[model samples]
Structures are given as structure tokens and as C-alpha cells.
Target: MSDDTDDAQPPRRLNSLEDRNAVVESALDRAIKRGDFDDLPGRGKPLTGLHGSSDPDWWIKQKLDSEGINGVAPAAFQLRKENAVLEDTVDAFTEESDVRDYLAGFNARVREAVMDLREGPPVFTPPRDVEKEVAAWRRRRNAMKNDSVTEAEPGDPEAEPGYQPVDPESVGSPRRWWHRFRR
Candidate 1:
């Protein structure tokens, strides 16, 4: 009979931690030789999260930032952002009554949110004064109007007042096919 022992492979025994480590290292080396780790995404880049915060929400924040997601900010943060743009929102209205109504609605919402016992960052935005906001809006609107008027004046010596010169070369002539079709 042929010897079965001669063809049989020996079983590996990890008797200690060092032997286990050596086996793992050998496997890793083989994988490296085979280029198993080459061409990986973010390869050679400094590993992220080393300098980042230890907060558990760090991954969520990073994902949201990388994906350009919005509306994920905390209620307090959202409220602060809304307050920052409140002036612009008020200025959008041309009528005093509309501005008053918008300010009242905004203040009411802020009050409601503040009164709620929900836990979040504290809302720091106080209620806005309608008269003061309206006055500021008027000043802002007048300044914009003045700036536009100044900009529209005939600044170029070659151009007439309120007339902007167009370059004929820049505006190419219609295609011959278009003219033929139109005719």
C-alpha cells in the first residue's frame, strides 16, 4: 500500500501568543505581497479622527457634513440661524403692516419654543422691536436704492446714460439655416 503519511499535510498548532502573532504576520505579509491593500480609497491620506473630538456624535456630524446635509442642526442652533436671518426676512416685506405681522408671528413662535420644557441649547434671541426693525429696514432699503441709482449712472464715457453698450461680435449672428427656415 502507498504511504498516506508522506502526502498528508501537518496541522498547525498555535500553542502561544507569539506563535499566533507570527502566523498573523505571515498572512499579512503574503497579502501585502499580493497587493491586496493597494489602490484603496483614501490611501496615503492622513488617518482622520485622530485630532477630532471624542464625542460619540462625531461620526454622524462628519457624515452629515460630507454629504452636504442640512436641517440636522440642534434646535437651538436652528433657532439661532433663523434669528440671524430674521432681519432679512423682515426686510423682504415692503409694507409696514406686513412687516409688523411677520415680526409678531416670529416672536410668537420664539416665545412658544422658549416656553416648551424640551431640553436643548438655550434660545438667546429676544423678541424683536417692530418699530426699530422697520426703521432699520427703511434705512437699508434707501441705501440699496441709492447705491443702485449711483451704479446705473453713465460711468463709461463712450456709453449714454441708462444705456449699456452690447458687443455685436459677442452676440453672434443667427445660423443661415435658421434664417432660411424663418423665411
Candidate 2:
């Protein structure tokens, strides 16, 4: 009975590797003829976000940028970026106390990153010296004040034409809240 059943069953034909390749090739050829891949965006242009570096995590960075996500970078990268702009940032503050506080907070974050055990890139950003930065900010502020004073000095030949020096007392006093309705 087993022999009769085997004889009755037809042999199943297994596809060879070449047969599979040929099927895929023919499908691709048909797709090409139909212009399925025509006019794709960035088809001929060199890829962006390479930035000439072979960083291993390039794909992840590309994904984040494509999604318009920000502030998700590793601590090391954020610290380095902040370090680069630290001087300009410190110079913007009007008060010495604010500058000191900003520097303290920045340094604290840097220190935290440096000591962090769970890692991505190593933190290479050095903490700013609060006193040194404050001194620099003070110098910048004084220099700006001197320049303004020199430029707006009354009766000075170097002063700009049609320039008027404002009366300090008049502008320095703030109008009360009711002053606006008085007008």
C-alpha cells in the first residue's frame, strides 16, 4: 500500500538558487521598464549630514534631524557646544551675579557629565573659572560704556552728525503705570 501511494504522488520540484535569482532579476527589469524608480528625491546628489566625518552614529543623527528633534544629543556634545559659546554668553549678562550663577550652573553640568559612569562620548569640556569669567564680563561691560560715552559726548567732533545725547535723569526715571492713561 505504501509503494502504491508513493508512486501515485508526483515529485515536488524545489527551485534552485539560480531560479530564485532569475525571478528577482526579471521583476526588477519589469520595474525599471515601467519607470517605477524615476524622479526620486536626492537621486543624483551626494548624501548630506556626512559633514566629511565618518562618525559611527551618523544614521542615528540623521534620523533625529529628519524628525526635527533637538536637545537629545549626548551630554558630551551639548557641553562642547556650550563651551564654544561660553565667552559670548557670559558677556551678555547685565549683572555680575547673573554671570556668576550662569557659570556656576554650566560648571556644575560639566562636572556632572565628567563624573557620569554611563557613557557615550567622553566629556572633554573643561569647567569655566567663575571669577575669571566674571572679571572678563566686567571688563567688556566697562569698555562698552566708555565707547558709548565717547561717541555721545556733547560738542565732540568725533560724535556722529545729528546724534543727540539723551538726558540721563529724564530717561532713567520710569513712568508710573497710570502715566500711560494720562496721555
Candidate 3:
């Protein structure tokens, strides 16, 4: 046991930048040999966000976008963002119960954010009126249903102009040059 302990090499000291670089290079080389990075996503694609543009916070923005991170902003900003898309989000839900629940949660968050005393932007996002929103959602849903039902199928007599169905029986017959103008 004493001989085995003595034979084991001590950890290498990385005192200089060059020494650190060499250590990292050797570890990366070993990883390459082990194929640790062989199946990474976007391995062959060109790197994005490298073009010239004047954006001071580009790096953080890129990181946030790449990581699919959301709801990490200040409460005021988050509530505002949610408010902007509230209508569309409400429309996406098929159930009235779900819409009510979503609206309740959103309203609670807005109220809480308004009450928060920590120094930040003011929360101007008002709590959504659940009943009104639900009513609007119902109206939109009904309108969409009506529109779909009203749409005429292709080859329908009620279909819009410029839509003519071709005759299968005449498809195999060769017509004269004047046939094209006869229509």
C-alpha cells in the first residue's frame, strides 16, 4: 500500500497561463480521442451571431435565446410581456375552466408584482378581468367555428370565382388549338 501511494503522481500545479492552457489542451485531446464531442448539436453548421452589429447586450441576449430561458426578467417587464400576449394565449385554451385558471394566476402575479417594494420599474400591467376575457374568448371561438362552417369546399358551386373543376372524361381526349380560346 505504501509503494502504491508513493507511485501515484501528485496533481499538476497550474501556476501560469501557459501551464493552464496546456492542461486544458491535453484534457480536450483526451476527450477527442474518447469521442466525447462527436455527436454535439450544430456540429457542422456555421456559428451564428458572429456578424457585425452594434448591440451592447448581444452576448447575454444570445445566451438567453440559445438556452430557451424565459421569465427570468424583472417582474414589471415579465408582467408587461405576458399582458402583451394575454389575448392570444387565452384564445389558445379550448376549455373555459382552463382560461379562468390561467387568468386567475396571471392576475395574482400582477397584483403581487404591484405590491413588491424592491426598487424596479413600476408594474403597469392591470389584472385581467376573468369574466370579460372568458366572454371574449367564447365569442372568438364561436366566430372561428362559424367561419370554418361557412367556408365552401373545393369544387363547390358556392366556391369563389376562377376555381373551375376539370372533367376527367375529357382529360384523355386531345383538343384542337381553338379549344383553349373557346373557354
Candidate 4:
């Protein structure tokens, strides 16, 4: 009876490519049914940098950007960003001495970074001419002052009597809650 039962069973064939695919698909379906992937981060977000480059490091770069990491940026890139905001930084200071000192420090750092031998994209920023920048800053400040004066003059048809332009710089810096607590 045992020999008859053994002979009655058919031989099992090795799984083919299609059979393996079906097995994987079934396993994925089971996982989905169990809500295994419901809470994953970036679930509906479109993939980034997919078409930007074929570089093998694309995934790593994407991960860094997604995490708001700035330490990974190239030195040249960081310098370029700083250069772009340099004018705003200079304009934020109301004193000529402060502006000159800031520009001098910035130029020195740029020169030092340019002299470094580490391989990266070339720094394209030229050192700022302090005198020329100071002149330009003066011109801008004078123009703003002239505009405010002209707007307030009584001779102008649209002038509001007793209207005075507020100097934004005179406002003291805002204090944070932590500062108040410390005091």
C-alpha cells in the first residue's frame, strides 16, 4: 500500500521565471493587505532628481537634500550662495565701518578658500573692492533719504501734512521668549 501511494504522487518541477514572479507578486499583495507599507515616509511624494543626472550618487544626493543637510554642498556652491546674498548682508548694516569690516572679512575668506587645493568646482567670485562698494552703498542710502524727504515735503501735492517716515533701523531688535525668561 505504501509503494502504491509513493508511485501515485507526481514529481514536482523547478519554479520557472514566471512562477517566481508570481510568488513575489503574491507576497507583495499579502504585505499590502496587512497594511505593512501604509505609514512609510514620502508615500505620495514624487521622486526627485530622477531625470536630472545618471550619476550613481543621485540617491545619496537626494537623501541629503531631503534631510535639509547643507554640509554636503561643495565649497564652490557654498561660496556662490554666500556671494549671492552678500549685497543683502552689506545693506543690513547701517554703519560704514561695520560694512567695511564685514566686506574685508568676507574677501579674506574667499581668497583663502580659492587658494585651497581640494578638488571642486572653481570659485568664480572675485574679491570685493571695498571702496567701490562703500560708494555704492552711500549712493543707495542717499537716494532713499532723498525719496523720503521729497515725499514728505509740503510743496508736493500728495504730501501728507506732519507725516514722517519711520526709520526701520531705529527699532530695537526683537527679544525672544527665552531672553525674557532669562531676565
Candidate 5:
């Protein structure tokens, strides 16, 4: 006697600004690594919506040709820009004593309201390329365990050059099933 229409799933939760922040960081990282700051001030101009900002290179050249400081021009500009972004991020987070007192603050009340707002949504099974992911993982694990490609004998001059030792940092990862998980 149950209707399937009553089992519809809820819409996904997402924040567009968070996605934009990630993209900006990615592009900024590539630009910084390549020393592509020729577009310095402009690197984040449109991205920051900072008006046709002063050119970073221009400021550097001016400072160098006049003041002889190797790091001041661009560094100073960046300091100002970072200061603004920090101010904006702070402004976005409202002052809330709400979470300070368990039964008092807005944070607790908001959380309660949200829980009430959500009548448990219907669950939906998502079709995923689990087989492909499994194959990829197997290929990776096999590669990690099969790194010896040389026929050289141990400690011989013919021994293969030092192994590019695997980092302990990269040796184990949470994604691997070998990592202990709480049942």
C-alpha cells in the first residue's frame, strides 16, 4: 500500500563559493610555481574583482630601478591583498555565542532546527564505477609491491642504484583497506 513517489530523495547540499575558492587556490598554485607572476597584481585581479589593479611586475621594476629592494614591491602588495581576504572571510562568519552555551546559543538552536527541518530523507543507491576503481587500486598496489626491475645481485657493484625509497608518509594511506577502521 506504499507509494514510490513518497520515497523521493532530497537534493544534494553544496556551496558554490567553496568550489570557487578551491579553483582559485589551484590556479594560484600553478601560477606561483611557474613564476608566472608577470601578471602579478593581475593574477588575482578579475578573480578578486579588484579593479584593474596595478601590475605586480611594474611595481617590482619600479621598486628595483629606484629602491633596490628585491622583495618589497610584490611582497607588500600580496600582504595587502591577503589582509583584505582575511577581513572578508572574518566578516562572512557571524559572531555567534550560540554554540558557547549548550542549551543557550544560536548554534545549538540552529542545529536543533536543522535536525527538525530534516525529516529523514529517502536514501538512493548511486551507480558507481566500483569495478574500475577496484582495478585501478589493484594495479597501484601491484606496482608498489613489484618495484624491483633489476637482475643485479645484492651489494654488487652491478647492484641497481639506490632505490628511490618509498616515503613512510606515502607508504600507508587511509584509502587502503589495510588501514585499521572502527567497526
Candidate 6:
């Protein structure tokens, strides 16, 4: 109708792309609003002037990511399993029960034993195998002494009790003295 003539055909429906994006935005907003969250104290509040930031999910995700600096939960499960294994390993022979029952019984017994100790007296006894204990200690001491291959220099601060020491002067080259001041 006018000289403009519509050769551009009114810029092909960009509404479809915008509408799709808006639908996605609405879904994300709903999901984020529905989630439970704890407020962080002292963290900066969102500024009104900022652009490109979406609502809700960005804040939720930021909070979640910050919280992960404390290590994940499953890693602690290893200690529980190892503790269970150690109970049997440390006592090779004892009265036995199914693993679940044993854990339950041990927990109850340990609780009662702690209460009993608090109340006092299971009558402490001296070791019956003092000679065996002494011999075992001697073997450990001898094994440590035998296994040590290097001798440490007396009064050397860098040397460990069982290890060899190096002279700091030996590690430097007498020739390197000139080179130290260059570049």
C-alpha cells in the first residue's frame, strides 16, 4: 500500500523462537520456586541493574554449588564399612552372629560397657603373657634397627632419627659461585 512495499515480508515470525524460550523460562522458574532452600547470610543480594541473569534456578544452583565445598556424603560410607570390617579383623576369634545382628549386639554391648565403666570396676589384671609381649617388642625394635639402611649424622637438623644426612655445602658447586650473581 505504501512505498515501503513489504519486500522484507514483515520479518518472518521471530515470535515462535521467543515463545519457545519463554515456555522454557516458565518451566525453569516453576521448578526453582517449588524447591526448598536455605538462605545464605552475608552473601551479596542480587542487583536490579544486572542483565543476562535468569531468576530462581540461578540462585538455587549457586547455593547448591557453594554447599558442595563440604565433601560429598558417600565418601563417609567407606569409614563405616571399614569400621565394620575392622571389628572382625582386630578380633579374629569371638562369639559370632549375623553381620546385622552382630553390629546391633556390639552397639548395645558397647553402650552398656561404657555405662559400666562409668559406674566403675571390672577389676584390672596384669598381662599373663609379659614375656611374649617383651619378646614381641624386642623383635619390633630389632626389625626397625635392621631395616634402617642409612645412618644420620649427629646434630644435623635435616636428618631424621633413622636416616642419612647430606651436607648442604656438598650440594653446591664451587664453580657455581660465579654463576649465582649472573642474571
TM-score of each: 0.44, 0.46, 0.53, 0.44, 0.16, 0.20
Identify the leading candidate in terms of TM-score. Answer: 3
At residue 9, candidate 5 shows an lDDT of: 58
Q: Write the per-residue lDDT of candidate 5 for residues 1-183, one digit (tens) a residue.
A: 468867985754547989778878988999989988776565654543245767767656765768766534333343334434532333333333221232133233334434453433321222224344344445654564576553567776645576565568877645767555746
Candidate 2 local lDDT, 1-183, one digit each (tens): 567887685743537988778778988999999999899998999976757898898888889889998877799999999999888888888888899999999999999999996977999889998888888888889998988776546677557677577787888668899998995
Order of the predicted models by lDDT, top scorer first: 3, 2, 4, 1, 6, 5
Runs in model 4 lying further than 4 Å from the true structure: 1-14, 42-89, 92-98, 113-132, 152-183
Q: How many steric clashes between backbone atoms does each model show?
A: 0, 0, 0, 0, 2, 0
- Candidate 2 global TM-score: 0.46
Report the C-alpha displacement of residue 36, candidate 2, in angstroms: 40
> Which numbered prediction scores highest in lDDT against the true structure?
3
Q: How well does candidate 4 match the true structure in TM-score terms?
A: 0.44
Off by over 4 Å in 2: 1-69, 152-183
Winner of 2 and 3 under lDDT:
3
Cα-based lDDT at residue 59, candidate 1: 83
Q: Kindly indicate the candidate among 1 and 5 with the higher lDDT.
A: 1
Number of clashes in model 5?
2
Please report the TM-score between candidate 3 and the true structure.
Answer: 0.53
lDDT tens per residue, model 4, 1-183: 667887785754537988778778988999999999998999999976667677987778778888988756677777788889887888888999998999998889788879985958888888899999999888888887898776545576458657577779867987677897784
> What is the TM-score of candidate 6?
0.20
In order of TM-score, best first, we have 3, 2, 4, 1, 6, 5
Q: Which window of 10 residues has the lowest lDDT sum in candidate 5?
A: 97-106
Candidate 6 RMSD to the correct structure? 19.8
Candidates in order have lDDT scores of 0.81, 0.86, 0.91, 0.82, 0.48, 0.51
Residue 148 in model 6: shift from native, Å? Answer: 8.4
Tell me how candidate 2 scores on lDDT: 0.86
